[model samples]
Target: MDRITLKEQLEKYRTPYEEESAFIQDFIQLTEDPLAFNRERLAGHFTASSWIVNPDRTHTLLTLHKKLGRWLQLGGHADGNENLMEVALKEAEEESGLKNLRLVENSIFDLDKHIIPERPHVPEHFHYDVRFMIEADLTDKLVISNESVSLAWFTFDSVVDMIGYNPSILRMLEKTSKSEILL
Candidate 1:
């Protein structure tokens, strides 16, 4: 997908969250280059993440990111991939070591823009993250990659306690709660 296509899709995305709506607008207006993932640009970049849930929708996979030392959803840099959905699924599989993952919806599940603190050679920058919901069997064994300290599934009800409360996670849960996929 090209930038135009992405912008059209994002514009059509419907959500009750005012913040997400504003994010979409900002993303469309901020960068005109297609290679938004280039770290050298220093104008922020696009990232793809999955809010991966078990088949029963009771638990979700999270990775204890080694670099950031935080429990976050599975995802990574776009790496110049214009198709964000494909990026999300690829990251999910690579991070979780799971197969047969299916998208819960074709549309984006969430949107967030956060600042990444500078580390060594990597300078500080913003990440405009696009999130999607993915479902996988709970029985699948997880493999922790070098990028993460560990990987685990947390119950939807206890995720906040397990990983600390995050507004993005809460917003994703709120949005999915109203859908049949989560029900």
Candidate 2:
């Protein structure tokens, strides 16, 4: 999908009220076009993730990515699937091991693109991340998956104070706090 195609799709389905569709639309756009990432090499490598807000609304869960070692929300690459939301949900379940998760289908946020530093075989990279907000019951014990070094619940305020979270996480926390998605 070229920029024109992506922009047309964005304009077509992207609304302040629609969530999943808009995210997937943008994800498709970024994956199709390289310029959307603002960096030349990041054309096709796109991903999606979810910020699983707890029932209490006071805290949000974050995973310390084992490879990146940064406190971040649960998400990963799309692997060329058309079902981007499923990708986000799957990542959340895999990373957090929480079965009772619920995605707020209408509470999607903007797509964020960030650089993933070059590595041995992967060349310099960036991820055009489509992010969503989900409300899950704080109803079960969370088992951090191998992909994460540690898992912890941080209050919205604490999440803001956290040293390594990307700016989009803060935006997600702010957006979720204002929505009725929290149980």
Candidate 3:
């Protein structure tokens, strides 16, 4: 996706929570910049994440992020990939080593705007994260990528109890738990 297409997608996205309206609008404005998808944009940049759940939605796959030292959904910098859905799929595959995972939906499952702490050479910045729901078999073999300290499948209740400490993660989990959840 190019700038126009990315902007269009952001414009079409609707968040159920009224408080998140600001994040949606900010993402739209960020897409106007030529460097919106580039990691080099220190102010902020686009990223894609996969909320990987089992076919029955009983469990989710989470990686103990090496950089953050916290269990997080699989995702990564967009680099120059304007198509976030492609980026989400690629990241999920690369990070989880899960093949033939199904995209539960083609549209956005969640949107989060958060700050990325500064690393040695990288300055702190915000990530206009676009999340997509994905499904994988529980019996599938998973290879832990170097990007994570470890990976595991957790029950939805456990995820809510563990990661729900973070408001953003809590929001996503709450959305997934609902039977009528939409993109």
Per lDDT, the best of the predicted structures is 3
User: What does the lDDT read for residue 88 in candidate 2?
Assistant: 83
For model 2, the stretches where C-alpha displacement exceeds 4 angstroms are 1-9, 12-28, 31-44, 180-183
Q: What is the C-alpha lDDT of each candidate?
A: 0.83, 0.68, 0.87
lDDT of 2 by residue, 38-93 (tens): 42345346577888887667888889888877898888876655355677889999
TM-scores of the models, in the order given: 0.92, 0.75, 0.93
Against the true structure, what is every candidate's RMSD?
Answer: 1.8, 5.7, 1.9
Worst 10 residues of 1 by lDDT: 30-39
| Candidate 2 global TM-score | 0.75
Query: Model 1 TM-score?
Result: 0.92
Clash totals in order? 0, 0, 0
Evaluated at residue 125, the lDDT of candidate 2 is 70
> In candidate 3, what are the lDDT values of residues 91-143, reduced to their tens digit?
99999999979998768888889999989999999999989999999899999
